[model samples]
Target: MALKFKMNRKGWLAVFAGLLLFAACESDPVLTGDEVSYAGDIRPLIDQNCTFSGCHGAGSVQFELLTYNQVKLKAAAIRREVWELQNMPKDRTMSLEKREKFKDWVDAGAPNN
Candidate 1:
């Protein structure tokens, strides 16, 4: 004998949505021609834009980006929020050049160098 399983419409939709999200997250990052450096380019931008008091700084509720390790851990979120969504830096706006640099760094695997 064979067993059979059934799912409702909502269940099917939920499964499809989850698969789509998984695929999106798994896809490789798109790289730009120019190289983006973590220390020289990205870190400065984070310090100037992201790590202010009450934001991503020390003792804050939000994710702290004080060090390379911390920033590297949240690299994906940073790309999504700052590069794609353009919703980060809550109080201020980052220049287009800076945003592109951030994307490039994340796409390059958020290297420590």
Candidate 2:
């Protein structure tokens, strides 16, 4: 019984050490080559946060941000309101990382993609 207990304890210790090594060897997630796109990244974010609450959608703001062109036209304003001033969504707020992505998109000339 004593020998069995010792073997099990050693086995558990080895497993724990292996797990630590595995976790330490793992790398942080990497971003792929595809640059952020308006359609892919920006539009979806706007659709969820901006357009849905009768905020920037139709019959809400004087300018509707539902479409790509509309958003593109107002990219500078979006950057100011969202990134610099951080007064958008009027309820909660986007994560800082998301806000950075939005700023990057705007800085990249607000592409239609």
Candidate 3:
């Protein structure tokens, strides 16, 4: 004997809807703007902005950004302050281009390279 399964219209619709929801919830990995490098792109920016005397470099703040480990630890906060809130630096603002670079770096998992 063979077994068969049949679904009513409502059941089929429910399954279809669930599949759509599942697919919609799945997101592809984001490829940020040109590849950003910690040494080549991010470090210089951080040095210029947050690494001056009495700043993030000198351990003045609760955290620091002088090294890759420190910066990675604070990556989420950095993104929020620099990109989302735009209230960091406390003295000046980063340019649009620089902010975009930072955002890209953060999106790329804040890699040390």
Candidate 4:
């Protein structure tokens, strides 16, 4: 019985280690080469986090950021809000993972991948 328990524990540890390794090695898909500047990175992230979070969705916000062109139109403002003013992504639910993704996108020229 003790041997079985030890084997199970080792197996679990191995599995956990493998999962961590995989997660650590994985990278976010920010911007590909065949993409535009506005569509790939900014719009989708804003739509997912800002709009879908019930903070700025349909009938929720005065200005919706649900589309590429919509977000593209406010490129300077969005960059300003996030990078300069630090006033966007109004939810604490936005993990550093998401923030890093957004930053990487911005750094990658805010492309449309």
Give the best candidate by lDDT.
1
User: Which regions of candidate 3 are displaced past 4 Å?
Assistant: 1-33
Query: What lDDT score goes with residue 32 in model 4?
Result: 50
Question: For model 1, how does the per-residue alpha-carbon lDDT over 65-97 read when each residue is reduced to its tens digit?
Answer: 999999999999999988899998786478878
Evaluate model 1: give its lDDT.
0.88
Candidate 2 lDDT over 1-113, as tens digits, reads 35544458889999999999888878643657656788789988898889865588887756789878888889999999889988886775689888887899888788787
The alpha-carbon lDDT assigned to residue 86 of candidate 4 equals: 61
* TM-score, every prediction: 0.68, 0.66, 0.66, 0.46
Clash pairs, candidate 1, are none
Model 4 per-residue lDDT at 106? 58
Clashing pairs in 2: 38-113, 39-113
Best by TM-score: 1
How many Å off is the CA of 64 in candidate 3? Answer: 1.9
lDDT of 3 by residue, 87-106 (tens): 77776567878887888889
Report lDDT (Cα) of residue 59, candidate 4. 68
What are the lDDT scores of the predictions, listed in order? 0.88, 0.82, 0.84, 0.63
Residues 23-82, model 4: lDDT tens digits? 877875654564333455456677666786466676665676776666556666666666
